[model samples]
Target: MSKELLMKVLNHEDTNGQLPWIPFAGVHAGKLKGYTGKEILTDSAKLIECLREVYRLYQPDGMPIVFDLQIEAEILGCELLWADYNPPSVVSHLFDKEKGIPCKCKFPTAESGRIPIVLEAMRVMKEEVGDQTALYGLICGPLTLASHLRGSEFFKDVNKNPDYVVQLTSFCAEYAQKMADLYIEAGMDVIAVVDPLVSQISPKSFSKLLHEPFKAVFDYIRMKGVKSSFFVCGNASYQIKVMCETYPDSMAVDENVDMVAAKVITDQYNIALSGNIPLTTTMLFGTQQDNMKGVLDLIDSIDNKKNLIISPGCDMPYDVPPENTVACAMAVHRPDEVRSMIANYSSSGFDDIEITIPDYASRDKVYIELFTLDPEQCAACTYMVKSVTDIYDEIKDMADYVVYKYFIKEDIARTAKMGLKNLPTMCIDGESVYISIIPDSDELITEVTKRYNKKHDK
Candidate 1:
């Protein structure tokens, strides 16, 4: 029938047993082109080029315009801590910590920071590949946006201040709908409400505080005659039934939720199912042979892929080897070849991947090890390493630190040895203090002093 890839998978009417594969690589595509996160995200031409490269490489049935959840948060006054390989992480919430209240902020508009960049990128991408492949307009889900704006306080507020959270969530949903309108106009065929935080709360809490707001977002997308999907990565098994009932055309979950089990749940509801490829262990670090094995395993686990879209569990890390992703696509399109490769493939050994934990009590000065993926390419690592430097003048007497450069690409052995899961991890006295998140200067200093004081007190 030569139907569009996404629609074929969404309806599952007759793909002729050809399961659609979607690779969740967005800004990470910039890495393949030697462009850093900052350069590509800021320049629409570069961003479009990155997307084009991804389309040419992976040839996904559907692809997200952006894998970043920080765009809407950025427009709403939440400051992002930018990185080289991955999307920016929200650092400063739009709330007054001292006052313990939500800070007043202006609503974001089309002219807001980077919204135009995103919308422009989508328009440009559609002109290039819209008719052939499904272009996804990714938006931050309401609870996630609220969390970005209000920080963890948003979670606490759900309990202590349900009314306040209800109001904030409503605003986020409306904001998402506005972005949805812009995306639909820009030629996006799908609206994915990406909300990873939803996994942290209970079903009861979700039903009480979040269900209606989320339902509204899906309802709005339906009114636009576009597909709406709820993307909740993490173990969100409890909400699968609720999500199917929430009115989204489909639901995508991460590897934490078993795809086979998820399929069983979604099957009963008759909604579409997608996602489950492991990002780090199998996708980023695994070899092509491993890729085939993992893909085959995922394919076997699902009862049926009729309405299922095979995809990575989460955003493919910025440095995920291109070959691994290509292998995944190969597993889908060239299964005979993959079967042959799997027959000859041998397992890799990591028997020596271990680093001795430092004894903080034995050291005179507190030791901090900052693991990074090339400061030359990664702004997040650059700033994180600098976070220590800026305070070194004051804490030098109490602490010492070192940096592991190109930690993901060149130093895979060391990365594995450190047991580091996220980039720019801050290890203090052999204990990881922060993963991906750059702690505030004051907070970092206080911990340093406290460690020093503990040494003297003993």
Candidate 2:
């Protein structure tokens, strides 16, 4: 019943007016079974255990086999920094502007890196849950894969060296197609190009650089007779129309994009819509009542439930209370029952969680604080942090820099105290300077320098 209903929604068909649900479990699945992300992601047995626990607890209509985007990068020769909670981050790149991409750098085969491990897990999960659940095979998007191979220089090359950027992203698109083929062979019901970085660029940049690569990979997936989805995180509302032009079977945006507004563009192309559940404020920090209310509210906001799949904005965090997710599942499955269960729900009661912000005027050095949803796991947060890291050496003498991860309960409280409205924001002297967008090195240095000079009265 779950698989059939999910396929109907993914296929943009009538699901008897029932909206499907897919929680991007990812590494968070490991937490349910008492396994660390590093332990479960590497060991098939542990990964399976965690996934089974998720199925038992959440009863998701669809779920990804593995959500780590670093798999392809690790295979392609990038060094990774592993974590116990979050997915690994690429610590080293294959190439940069100073050193061009090596001739030896080529596409990965099915046997490369951890593909065998992931494929083995995928095959088994298909047999374990495929009868009732839709298994999603998530492949890294071209822009993100390019960032892995070329480091942060990939973003700067958009303006400096367009031709080189094209060549690299073209190669990445080919890699994505091959990955889709492997996932299809392993019996994946859907192939999602999980490219969170798409939210950072402008619509014009996407049209000029990424349009063809995205279209090519999605076209390949469609030809293979597999349902496809374009999954993006951060605030991607601005480029929703351009993203639709690529023509995926469905489009999933995170909590940042308005679902009502996004549904209009996706519906224009007859594509199904999924997501916009707040991961931090609601899922991680908010109570179970808040989670139930969120799911119910999202369901109420959408008049057309024909092509909607209720889900979190992005991947669920490591310690997002299982009861909260259970609450979400109950709301999605039995909205009326859950609605009565939490009719008078209020998100208050955090009044006692005190957070004292720093005094900007009294500080001798210019202060720069980066607020993120853990850069290690989030593509947008990774580059936004790198934007500051790229210029840190020059500003070290005059500016004090720190990163505040929203995953921590303390940081979540700090967000409310500091009046932060967005994740992965850069604040200078307690003021939000850059929102979701990553600033270029030159501009970052200039801003820090101006602040430092003002503080010194020079």
Alpha-carbon lDDT, every model: 0.77, 0.87
Alpha-carbon lDDT of model 2: 0.87
lDDT tens digits by residue: candidate 2, 1-458? 29888899887788777878888898999989889999988998888888888888889899888999999898888899999999999988888546365343467677888888788888998998898999999999998998888887777787778888778888889999989999999999999999988888789988998899999999999999999999998878888999999999999988778899889778878999999788987898889999999889998998888889998989899989999999898989888899899977787835677788888999988999999888888988999998878777888998888899877778888977888766778899988888777777777888988988988888
Candidate 1 regions exceeding 4 Å error are 1-3, 96-107, 344-346, 349-351, 355-458
Worst 10 residues of 1 by lDDT: 96-105
Clash pairs, model 2 backbone? none
lDDT tens per residue, model 1, 1-458: 11285686666465666777788886678987889887788888888888888989997788888877888878777788877766788778777352132333555566878878888889888887877788888888988788777765554576677888888888888888887888898888889998876765677878888899899999999988989889986567777887777768888987657778878988887788888887766787788888889888788777676788788876777878999999999997777778887986765744556546567778899898887654433434544676687578999999998888643443556666777755657888878887655565677889999988888884
* Cα RMSD, each candidate: 5.7, 1.8
Candidate 2 lDDT at 382 equals 95
Error of 1 at 359 (Å): 10
